[model samples]
Target chain A: MVETDMNSQAKADRKAGETVLVADDIKRHYEIPQGAFGKPRILKAVDGASFTLQRGQTLAVVGESGCGKSTLARVVTMIEPASGGSLRIGKTDVVNASRSQLAALRSKVQIVFQNPYGSLNPRQKIGAALEEPLLVNTNLSKKQREAKARAMMAEVGLRPEHYDRYPHMFSGGQRQRIAIARALMLDPSILVLDEPTSALDVSIQAQVLNLLRDIQKRYNLAYLFISHDLSVVRYIADEVMVMYLGHPVEQGSRDAIFASPQHPYTKALLSATPVADPEGKRERIVLTGELPSPIAPPPGCTFHPRCPMAADICKRLVPPVQRVCGTTSWCHRPWEAETESAA
Target chain B: MSLLEFTNLSVEFETLNGGFRAVDNVSLTVDPGEVVAIVGESGSGKSVSMLAVMGLLPWTAKVTADRLTFQGRDMLSMRPKEKRKIIGKDISMIFQEPTTSLNPCFTVGYQIIETLKKHTDLSRAERKNRAIELLRLVGIPAPERRVTAFPHQLSGGMNQRVMIAMAIACDPKLLIADEPTTALDVTIQAQILELLIKIKEENDMGLVLITHDMGVVAETADRVIVQYAGQQVEQQDVKGLFRDPHHPYTAALLAALPERATGDQLPSIPGVVPGQFDRPAGCLFSPRCSFVFDRCHKEQPTQAGKELGCALCHTPLVAGKPQNEAA
Candidate 1:
């Protein structure tokens, strides 16, 4: 059976530590036709974003709605091709991977969407849903595939008896667990989790988080966790990337980013996040105005318009990326603020 | 004097599955110039209770209350016309999704003008000017330009501000914001909350905030009402609620927060909130509660005292009676 070989291979894979993914200045821009006679406008959904993912680690990309984090995730998951720059997963060049290589890439990299119910087919049984990935990616026979599906179900903490049940029979958290199980069916090295727990309740969210953490530890999988919830990021992310209007404002280890965020935007984000403690009084920095539209983003520092400490130079020239205290922060006045106290 | 008061208010919806009680004998009061936050998760009846108060629930819903009063006027006994007069004039509401709440066909300025026209007798030019003034008051940049823009043209935060502007167009005495900032970004949420606080203080209006986020409740609410399975679990001043929660559900909810988790495993409530059909005969939260015992599964327990904070548990988890008596 493939189970014995697969189990040993997984163990070996865990032992071999390696860089799983490297994304360099990846850009995903879309052109939309304005009207019948109007010129097409370019919407830079993701403009010049880069990050690295290592096995057994999670790199979280945190941003608001228009900040291009989701776009970046889509690009990584190969749902859409990047407009420019390079994306390499292990040895495969993501942009130009051949047909066979693309299939291999699909097996190596999988994605879990925000809504589990939407991701899974309504009519498909839980067993068939988990088996579909194996059938597409591998040449496993009927009996072998069924066994693998059952094993995967138990691995995700679902009963093997639940294999024949439909998705609607399960609760939201259970459905998400099935989604995670399906993603792990191919034994993918990288999992692009896009707001996996956002739709779930808080208690359920904690359960899913614990599950993901356990899965990462067991499989030595690299996770590209994309979420807008900072508290979740603080709990799960090894490294964090803060995005503003389709650009990276700050990226570093979770400790450095949370403890001592250099960019004013990062500081404001941290300050704006309401703490659960009612007695704790933290300086709440409320940024005025809304997130600038990605269609015609502000020149120079994209955050300059809403930035409180914006100077003349900030508007005129783009801020250079400077490494300070083990973090890469892009800002004009990085030294204006000090590190914040830990929660 | 209380601006809004609900005594033994219960709301039930008639479905094929029978009457599903959403708000069960929940009593609370909101005074003028006070911000009362109703905190609960989905299906906890926080929003439903507020909707019942607004008289906005569907026709299928059966609402019954002992004393549903607003500014000493009996809301339950009042004629439909009289109730309609006060609603959207003296009492206005801003929903969670600002985009959906505001009419997409009309411009924001037009909506504000419509609200002003319905409630107040302002002249054409005066209404237009007041609409622009309301936009400026909510801190929209270039109110002159934004007033003409449609809801879709504006960002989520801007639309929310526009909603706030429209909600206060009649200079409403009470504003019911149901998860007003839930749809916005954190920074944008902070701005909206600050704006709500500012407006509530300046206008001297009672604000009823319904939200699921304890952080927002902690930051903005003057008093907190914790709901569980359509019943009031605990009610206290915002500070006292956080300092020492009386109910296990409230304590567990606070503990479940990612920040409060001192260990790797968060103290999560094991089961989900039971549906109306499957609700246990005793305490509704007994299924998920950690300290559930025999009595918790047998008979429902009532609140301890009228003035002091109390929990709906057989053995009330009293965190020393809250000194501040709610007026």
Candidate 2:
């Protein structure tokens, strides 16, 4: 059984292309029922969102809470199936794979959730929790899984003595390390991190992010890092995708997004971030009115309601990326010698 | 004298695990209209410290302080009636989640009106007018009609604004906002912080902002108090703390934060936060501090000096070295 799992992983590694994950126009909608029985309105949590994760690169998807960032991560990791659109991982089309095929795909991508306290089962020992993934994915003997789980625990910077401790015994940062180990039990090529260190302390947050970066470089892994923290995103993301109401408002390299953003929403978000620099003098743009509900987003562009540069056309049509500047060129205005526009 | 002074404040709670000190011997002072941010991690006692000052802790909790004098009044031994009178009327509070803090059964107007009516002998029409004025003051639009709306009808940001409006209904001298904008979006959080700063200045109200984000302190705080593991590691003016943090913990904290402008990749502190079970006798930050020497492990450093030199520093001051050197 151990031999079979090893052989499969080896073959899978070879078969897997450099681009580990591809999410094409992914849509994850849920029918949230209102009232007794009338028509149940659909919530397009991931409304036609699309991005790709290449080997050794971090694709940070950032947005405010309730902007469907977690929903997008769930779909990318295949925890919750997409309502529409396609998701391909390592040349394998997983959007509609069979039961066995999906199971195989699960081993290829794994997710590290937000709360370390909630993710691990308190009933199970640290060793047992880490062993569960190996037990499910590989046809390994109990003893083999136990040994592998111990090694994986060590891989995440946990001591071997911590194997028998309960989840409550560890600090938030250590528990996050344990969660990372559990996710790596199957040696996944892609990791979908959903605010993995949000619950940890600032000093500890740095350690966890550093550990993730080290691991990513060591394994040549693709990361779909989802977080609302702009500072964290700036640190780890190679490329960034800004989402508003489940739609990709901007997609570009990290340097591009931080240096000069074209989207007004992105600009506001960047300006809104609180920096420790006493010298930072970027004028903050406080958008009037609340973020429109995802259930029934504003027509035309999702950001038109809050955009300072909003024009008549912005309120009538959805904005699409027309070019790439620093990150992926994202803009609603036409690209030419210079098409004058805002919003 | 400061507008509000808290000296040697400590909070303890009993649990199945045993008695744990939620807040250590912490001391701070908020001058009139100054924003003093108490910042640290989840269990850093920032929230508990402020709650103890407000006398809002549950029955299970115990509080002790050598001095908790607000405007020269003994806060620790004040009569329940006296404390109650001062709390809403002179020193109001705000929490992180507004929905839970706000009474959902009543309109925002009623909540503010209750606060007003409890303290002032005002008529219903006057209270309603004041409520509308407050709602508008906190950046909530169309406050005249919105005051009648329930808390559920408002957005998170607006609800927070309503919460702030209710807090400042009586023009409290001291405003204690505990993680007030932690749950809000970044843009909303910025606006709320800005509003807090504006209101503090306009009203000349002393502000105590408790949060985990160091960046928030750097942006909004006139003074900064950094707590860790229920102990105050450092306290200084915001400029001094940012420019030349005396404590190594404060330095590490400043270093840990990722700067959007600085080209340097963020440098994370090593190791995890210490749990209650493993809190050693010495400095709470010794395990994470990069420059820890013999004294940090062997002997605990006391809160050294009274004002400008209050932090526990291992490195001796070098002769002729500049004082306000940037890290």
Candidate 3:
């Protein structure tokens, strides 16, 4: 795998293409069966979220648990159809695509789940698991698919001899590598990774992150990385979108979000995340109260209950989305904190 | 005097194959009103050592210690009843999964009151009032309503708060919290840690926080203990530990954090923590240590300081040198 080297050529080729995935006001909600009392409640899993992922770059979706980030990924990956809005891959409209079109779109966008062990069939060998995608997606013969699987295994830093091994035989990190290899087997233009390395140890986590970086560079694949870890997001994401209770509260570049977060929820999240450096100390903003249930969300600004600077206006009126300091933040008081800090 | 002290403490479990030593010669002390953190990866014996102290090990395990004392009282030699008096009263414990640790069938108030009843002489109504007060102390809103709620009725963070209320019911002198906030969200974790620190300070309690996250240790711990492969490799003040880690393992661990990453790639330790059967004959970390030499393979090194802070290496990193020089 190390024998073949492509420097800037693949990156330049990737940039030559247009946006890989464009999601415009996508929504995914579920109807829950309440006690035979009143109308059924609607669980707004992914409510009116929109973002565009460029080629050769990563767009990270971050939030606490139950924030609808994973649901957005599911919608993009076509695991579940979006209830509203449009999703496009290149020029293909995935939201309202037909059966054969979706079959083709499957090779364009793929997903890697959080638990690698659960994603892969324990009974299947690594070679067979990797080849299954090729068999279903392409018209390649069995021998050709086997050769490609061995090459893909080697490309992911695994030996060809280990291709015959079962899923249980590999470690957590190795299994994740296999999962990544399987996702890339069809050469998908877009990859949605959901908490890929959260299960591995720190040392092993580093290895997997580096491996992902190398694979990204080689393939120049557009990644929709979903994680709750800000530190990892800071390292991997070119752009970030902060979601809260099925709403995208803030979206900006990595530097903009990390250096100067405008939204109160974004600020709270950044401060609450403890820095690994012991010598590095910063004042933390601890949010009070639990996340409101998505089934029955609060009116107006959803974060007003736990927001530190929440005013009377915040509770009564929905904050309008405004561009502030290179970031689009939905807040009642936008960039006021930044101006004060500057003064 | 220290509130709790353990010297040369070791714990081993007898499996079907053979004996597996979970903890090895770990010496640590906790002074009153201080937060001492034990940091390590999985199977590093951080949890096992604390479990040994709490006498919560399974029947297959064997515990040994030259000195184990709490408030000048010998814990290892104490009678069964005496140990019981101190275990839940003066020295309480909290675990990672509060949902599992708490009894789901019983109300939160009942559990807190039971702890109070076992340790203090109070009327039933007084115990109930104290339970409500404890819930308020742990920052649970609407304590009166929450006190009667079952474990399933509350969220993960609220259940953890209830667990804390029960632990501090007896006003324990020492609280051993094992990964108390590991299962909660970051915001919730910050709240829980702040509550723990506030309670520890107000009551002058010594807290032993067992966690693997360096960020949590740096933020909450006054002193830090670094363990690897069931042995205590390094111990230092929080500032000192971050500024100049003595052991190669500690330095590597800090470097491995994604937040501390500098270049395009991270400096990962090459291998995972060795299992019991695959451990090296000499230094436990020699296989993964980048600074390992021929001597490190043949013999184990000991801590040079008067206290038990050993790197177990011949050519350990000096105070001023860069931590990732070997990398």
Candidate 2 at residue A163, lDDT?
Answer: 92
DockQ of 2: 0.58
lDDT of 3 by residue, A1-343 (tens): 3212332343455662359889999999999988889688899999999899887789999999899999999999998999999999878898778999999888879888889879999999999999999988888789888878998998889988888899998888889999999999888889999989887777888889998888887887889999998888998999999999999999999999998889989999999998866777588999998898999888889999999888889899999988888899999886555477679
Per DockQ, what order, best first? 3, 1, 2
In model 3, the Cα lDDT at residue A34 comes to: 82
List model 1 lDDT by residue over B1-327, tens digit each.
Answer: 899998999999999988999989999898888999999878889889988988999999999999989999999989998998899999999988898889999999999999888878889999999999999998998999988999999988899999999899888899999999888889889988988889889889999999888889989999999998899988889998898787888888887787777787777777677886688878898888776777778888778673446677665455633222321
TM-score of 1: 0.94
Question: How would you encode candidate 3's per-residue C-alpha lDDT over B1-327 as one tens digit per residue?
Answer: 999999999999999879999999999899999999999888899989998999999989999999999999999999989999999889989988998999989998888898988889999999999999989989988999988899999999999999898888888999999999988878999999999999999999999999988889989999998888888888888888888887888888889888888999988888678886687887888999887777678887766573324555556666634233352
Q: Over 4 Å off in model 3, which ranges?
A: A1-17, A139-141, A337-343, B306-309, B319-327
**Per-residue C-alpha lDDT of model 2 across residues B1-327, encoded as one tens digit per residue:** 688897888898987798888888998888897888888878788888888887888987889889888899887788998889998989999988998988899998899899999998889899989999999999998888998899999888899999999899999999999989887889899889989988888899999998888778878888888888888887788877777777777777887886632543456777655655778767777887776766677777766664544775545122313233332
- Residue B81 Cα positional deviation in candidate 3, in Å, after optimal superposition: 2.3
Clashes of 3: 1
Candidate 3 lDDT for residue A246:
98
Q: What is the interface RMSD of candidate 3, in Å?
A: 1.1
Candidate 2: where are CA atoms >4 Å away?
A1-17, A32-40, A333-343, B12-19, B59-62, B103-110, B141-154, B260-266, B272-277, B305-308, B314-327
Query: What would the TM-scores of all predictions be?
Result: 0.94, 0.91, 0.93
